[model samples]
Target: MARYAEVVRWPLVEALAAYEHRLREHARRQYELDFIAWCILAQSGATKRKRPPALPTILKEE
Candidate 1:
């Protein structure tokens, strides 16, 4: 369990740092929001499917 704790702790710290940076940059709040969602998903052991697209994907269907 020690290994797991170390791994989890570092990422949590990093996420907080990133969140602070985003707040300074005055970017949209969505990124910080998404980070919180991602943490919840990780804790729930919900397997994520394929990675998200590198760029935003917009659908223009009629």
Candidate 2:
């Protein structure tokens, strides 16, 4: 079975880079995408986090 962290990490790395690139091209409002992408990265990494922003609610809820 695939390790869960390894599986999750690949997409996170890709998304963060993509979001950062897109953020530079987008208008100011689009900063939200970059912010949310980072929240996911910081949250999922389970690193030493000091008061990370709350993720925007419910882009896709199960």
Candidate 3:
């Protein structure tokens, strides 16, 4: 849990610092996992794999 502080903090701090130091157009997001999404991911860490992948590889049968 403590290890994930960077994952949650980096993007927000990065964005805020970018805006503070640079223009909005120049400030690109470094990560997709913002604070809210990170919270969700942390809460639901164990995602259930009830169904097979939507695009499973096809195989030739003998």
Candidate 4:
């Protein structure tokens, strides 16, 4: 997992940083919510009791 993290997580972090940098540059309206707030809202909508479908289950059904 550590090896995977170094290869995968580092690129994801860099991509997200680039995305946020572009958003700051091009967005006309400033975001009312910060990153932490957006993360909380994202996870709040995906609670354990109301989770999204599992990838395996969906693939099997298809």
Candidate 5:
């Protein structure tokens, strides 16, 4: 629970940071219990996935 702070807190931080090509990549990692719980929660969701509103364009159009 305590260990998932970074992943949950900065879920979209990396994506936003990547546009500048300055994002650092971390090695693949996962927490066992958290992963299992996430899987269960994800499965419990209804069949339809809700689409979020479009994000503002980060980079300028060419």
Candidate 6:
């Protein structure tokens, strides 16, 4: 995962973090895996935000 982290552009960190937060909030049991699934859903245009936004990315660390 560290290798993948290196490839993440700094600007997109917020989008990723936002997805993780949503996962934690709504799918607390398996937030990690759910976050990935949410990304897939959003990317496939199955979610409200066809393209995730960065505003929600300003999440406080847990």
Report the number of the highest-lDDT candidate: 6
RMSD of each candidate? 16.1, 15.7, 17.6, 15.5, 13.3, 13.7
TM-score (all chains, Cα) for each model: 0.34, 0.29, 0.22, 0.28, 0.25, 0.30
Whole-model Cα lDDT of every candidate shown, in order: 0.54, 0.58, 0.44, 0.50, 0.43, 0.59
**Candidate 5: misplaced stretches above 4 Å?**
1-30, 46-62
| lDDT, model 4, position 13 | 75
Which of candidates 1 and 4 is the stronger one according to TM-score?
A: 1
Candidate 5: the clashing residue pairs are none
lDDT ranking from best candidate downward: 6, 2, 1, 4, 3, 5
- Whichever of 2 and 3 has more lDDT, that candidate is 2
lDDT of 5 by residue, 31-59 (tens): 33444555666678843434322322332
* Highest-scoring model, TM-score: 1
Per-residue lDDT of model 6, residues 1-62, tens digit only: 98568546556778677767776576444545556777988777785645443322323345
Give the runs in model 2 whose Cα sits over 4 Å from its true position: 1-26, 46-62
**Candidate 1 residue spans exceeding 4 A from truth:** 1-28, 49-62
Checking candidate 6 for backbone clashes, the offending pairs are none
Estimate, for each residue in 1-62, the C-alpha lDDT of model 3 and write its tens digit.
98666546777878676555544222223122243455565577735443323321221110
Residue 24, candidate 6: Cα error in Å is: 11
By summed lDDT, the worst window of 10 consecutive residues in model 6 runs over: 52-61
The weakest ten consecutive residues by lDDT in model 2 span: 53-62
**How well does candidate 2 match the true structure in TM-score terms?**
0.29
> Which stretches of model 4 miss by more than 4 angstroms?
1-10, 28-62
* Candidate 6 C-alpha error for residue 22, in Å: 21
